[model samples]
Target: MKAFLLVGFGGLAGSMCRYATSLLFTRAQSDFAWGTWIANVLGCLLIGLIYGLSEKFQWLTPEWRLFLTTGFCGGYTTFSAFAFENLKLLESGNYWTFSIYSVTSFAIGLLAVAAGVFLTKM
Candidate 1:
């Protein structure tokens, strides 16, 4: 229950932050998805930094980890979590699994989006 609350509240906050940050990059005339691109990159960097810090520092707790990574980063951009997991897989020399994950994630994500768009247009 406590973990759920922590994640929920943290996710809310993280989502708000994502919205605000993305708004900063939004341009009415621009066709590029800069806002999403920037958000994903920033989220990945932040997740990596937080994870590294938690690994190096003994003071960071499990609750904090849940709030920051699973909750905040998860809400901000799931791409960051995917990136983090892929990095871990690569670091551990699980090249086959990493390759599968990377390829499938991209392919499935694009397919899913296209499907959604097609459905919406219908």
Candidate 2:
């Protein structure tokens, strides 16, 4: 029950933050789904940091790990949105944009995670 509450609260906070980020990107008036991309990449980076710190420094308890990684990061990252956006782009015949978005999101997201873990070492 305690664990559930922690994760729930973390998810609530993460969801709200994600929404705010989306709104900020919406104001940019760009066709690309910058909000979703940034959110996912950031989420990955955060999770990496959390895991790395927890492992290296033994800083986070299991409960904290659950809250931050499973709850917060899971809520913040939007794989569904990514998939839907790709579908829309494909349907609209934006192959080039779709390719670039999909490829870069994957590549950069991985790099972001690596970078986060690397930062912990420094």
Best candidate per TM-score, number?
1
- 4-34 in candidate 1: lDDT tens per residue? 9989988998899899878999787999888
Taking all chains together, each candidate's TM-score versus the true structure is 0.94, 0.61
- Which pairs of residues clash in candidate 2, taking residues 3 or more apart in a chain or in different chains? none
> Would you list the C-alpha lDDT of every candidate in the order shown?
0.92, 0.81
Q: What is the lDDT of residue 33 in candidate 2?
A: 88
Q: Report lDDT (Cα) of residue 74, candidate 1.
A: 89
Winning candidate number (lDDT): 1
**What lDDT would candidate 1 get against the real structure?**
0.92
Backbone collision tally, model 1: 0
What is the per-residue lDDT of model 2 for residues 11-104, given as tens digits with 9 covering 90 to 100?
8888998998788765466788888778877776677678778989999989998888777876787563466468679989999999999999
Off by over 4 Å in 1: none
